[model samples]
Target: YGAAEAGRDYNTTDMSRQRMYNEYLPPYKAAVEAGVGSVMSSFNDINGIPATANKWLMTDLLRKQWNFLGFVATDYTAINELSAHGLGDDKKVSELALNAGIDMDMVGEIFLRNLAQNIKEGTVKQADVDQACRRVLEAKYRLGLFQDPYHGVSEARAKQVLMQPAFVQAARDVARRSLVLLKNDNQTLPLKNTANIAVIGPLADRPLDMLGNWSGAGDAKQAVSILQGIKNVGGATIRVTYAHGANVTEDAQLIARLNEHGGQLDIDPRPADAQIAEAVAAAQKAEVVVAVVGESQGMTGEAASRADIGLPGRQLDLLKALKATGKPLVVVLC
Candidate 1:
């Protein structure tokens, strides 16, 4: 599919060729081996050459050495950022990237704006442009897009398959196996069905957070929150209580940026102390307390970073409060 700089958008990836081959290259190589239709160039430099304009990477390693036939597309605005990376101006960078082996310019109209003029000026060869276009067309042809652009996408089919029972069960099965149980003391393994359980945290009942970052076309409503999943498995016999112990963060700037696209942050307006008090109250009454806490949905994905990567806002306080309750504490990080 695509790659990122150090698995984060726009982050710097500085490493030796030996290290890249040993660690970073393997995944992309494997993807190439699997016949991925296209490879998106990362937003970082490879040995001081920005990936978008790195001929050695896109041409020598990816195409000639690895035998990757798919076209290379630039990550969002990556080609344009060559100027920011001190490579060149728009026209210069665009031509450089295209010659270097970038076949598609994603969200940056550098190619659209300058490639023709560059070709006329003999700055970029028409054959190189033709070659790039051929690769992209070949990928599209292989995907059967040329034959039927819609490719069987329909509202009826979407309704039939989206969150289908079989798919949901498969997801649940995968999720169950993916969980890593780091420790279990005093054989306090699975709780008895009769035990009272308190599921407390900002994320416990948050369906939106369950979908996670980059959940394309996946509806939050289709996701089963931790609270819902517990309730579903526990049935009517087991007691289950829930409390949102804290907002994901109280940072106004972060919240504003997070809400810019729409209010995905889900920052609770209640006072931090009030939220902590409620959680502590729930913990006091329950036989076992499950405190769900961690980075909010907006905190981990593209263009998002934290100077202090600990628990955000009063989540630490809520956790400390829950710990002091002396109830069996089960901490779940989102």
Candidate 2:
């Protein structure tokens, strides 16, 4: 229902129908079989047609063949992207999407602006539009939105649910179990309580980075940093040190793009060499070094992609320096 290339937003996915069914289509089919209320079309094209305007995918496969009873929605601004994908202008593509069996458009007003004109000009059938509207309305009715639009939403409820102790503990427990120990040479993990530990890298103390992408309504201030987690768990017996090794990236343009929502990147103003030197100093004092690294929260979500998806900026340099310190190293990726 979401994304086309392994859920990396706005990324392209090109594959044949056989490949789709063999791999990518199963999850969507499973969602349909599970009676998901609605399905959002992926941003990528299936075969040649955009998923939003692919009749074979949206209508033939999803509705007729798979028997998906739910309404189909387009991903954010996806209908508008049809023109960019060399399909057509807003008006033409909007009609194509509707005729293709898309019931709802997300964050693009193309349908609202052009559908009526399309109908009057005989370009779009009114019955098709009516059918799409009917499906959307039926979904709302099924969700009881017509009876109570404000169901389960209140300022009091928000306060009660957000960061509740039980919820936080449950989240922690799930995260603990999800961790995979890929390799552990010399039994390096489960560090001794007596050892001096140093936690380094920009992400080590970054609470906002811990919330990750698509963390809706979740406060960054309430999130705990890895450094804090280590300190909290290590207790009085264990010795711990911390230093931020480098900013996530030093590319001014990327930082500007990431901070468009206002300082989301959290770029440090310190010189990269100075940051790495501080981290090296910290590494020297500890028996073991835990280097926390990787993308900022903004680096992987919607509209964000990379030509080279390696460690950003001087992070790899910092890692190299930590390795040179001759201390046992643990790299924790965000």
For model 2, residues 55-126, the per-residue Cα lDDT tens digits are: 998999999999998899998888999898898889999888888889899989999999999999898999
Q: What lDDT score belongs to each candidate, Candidate 1 first? A: 0.85, 0.87
**Tens digit per residue, CA lDDT, model 1, 1-334:** 1234446666566777787788777987898899888888877876677889999999999999999888889999889999999988999998889989999999999999999999999989999999999998998898899999999899999989877899999997998898887787765567765468999998898888887777777788778889998899889877899998998888989888778855476667889999899889988989898888987687887677676879988899899999999988888888
User: Which residue pairs overlap in candidate 2's backbone?
Assistant: none
- Residue 296 of candidate 1: its Cα lDDT? 69
Each model's TM-score, in the order given? 0.90, 0.90
Q: What's the lDDT for residue 11 in model 1? A: 57
